[model samples]
Target: MMYVFLGKNVAQNRELAQMLTQFQLEFELLTYDDIDETILNFCMAHTNDCFDLLTDRLQDYRSRSDISYSELCQLILSDVEKHIKFPLVIKDDVVYAGLTNAEARSLLLPKKVRFMLSRQYLSKSYHVMMARKKVS
Candidate 1:
C-alpha cells in the first residue's frame, strides 16, 4: 500500500484522505508541521551562532578563492546531488512508502498514530524517509 503525501494546503489532501478512509485503507499520515520543526532544528544546528561566526567561517573558506555565495552554494549542492532517493517508513513490521495525502492523513488522523508514525519516519534519513510500502 504505497502512497504519496500532499500538504494540507492542497485540496488534494481533503479529497485523498476521505477517499482513503472510505476505502478502509491501512496507512499513515505525516504532517508538514513535523517536517518544518525538523528542518528548523537542522538549520539552527548548521548555522553559525552569530553573524561574526558566519563571517569568520566564510572568510576562512574564501581566503584564497573569490567565489560568490551563490557559487559556494552551487558547490555544496554539487556534492549533495550524489545522494538523493525516495523516502519510506517501517512500523511494527510493515514498510510503507509513496506517501500520498491519503496515507499521511491516516498517520495524522490520530495523535497516537501520528506520534508513532513520526517517530519511525524520523528514524530514517530524511533523504529517503517516505512511506513506500511494497504490495503484498
Candidate 2:
C-alpha cells in the first residue's frame, strides 16, 4: 500500500518519515510547498469528515490577521505552508494527522509485531519456540 504524507520539511515530518521507513511502509512525502490545487482537492474529496477539522484549524490562521475567514481559507489553500499542521499521514483510506508518539507507536505496533513474528518463524529461533509454548 502506498501512503501519502503531507507536511513541511521539518523535524517532526522527518521523524514521521523515519518511522515509516523503520516499519518498511511505502510512502510518498509531499511538503506544503509541493501541494497544488489538484492534490488539495483530492485530499478534500477523500478526507470525509476530517476536512471539517482541517477547516476549523485553518480558522485559527484568520485570527492572526484582519482577513475574512473565506479569504484566509483561500490563502491557506493556495499556500498551505501558512496553515498546514505537520505529519499528516494518509493510508488505506484513513487519515492520521499530528499524531503524538504514543499514537504513532500504537498505529505501527501491529505491523512491527507481524514483522518480528515472521522473522522469528523464518529463523526458527528459541524465542519463537518460547512464544509457541506460551500460546499453548
Model 2 scores a C-alpha lDDT of: 0.61
What is the Cα-based lDDT of residue 117 in candidate 1?
A: 63
List the candidate 2 regions with Cα displacement exceeding 4 Å: 50-57, 60-73, 108-136
Task: List TM-score per model, in order.
Answer: 0.25, 0.58
lDDT of candidates 1 onward, in order: 0.43, 0.61
What tens-digit string does per-residue lDDT give for candidate 2 at 1-136? 6454556556776676677688777677666666666655555566664344263556555347676545644766775764555555566666666566557756744676667757876788777888999999
What C-alpha lDDT, on a 0 to 100 scale, does residue 64 get in candidate 2?
A: 73
lDDT for each residue of candidate 1 in 1-136, tens digit (9 for 90 to 100): 4233334345655666576576565656554333333332343244343122122333355464677655644443343212111122333333333345556567435566667767877778553544454322
Looking at model 2, the pairs that clash are none
C-alpha RMSD values across all candidates: 15.6, 6.7
- Predicted structure with the largest lDDT when compared to the true one: 2
Question: Which portions of model 1 show Cα errors greater than 4 Å?
Answer: 1-4, 36-136
Please give the RMSD of candidate 2 to the true structure. Answer: 6.7
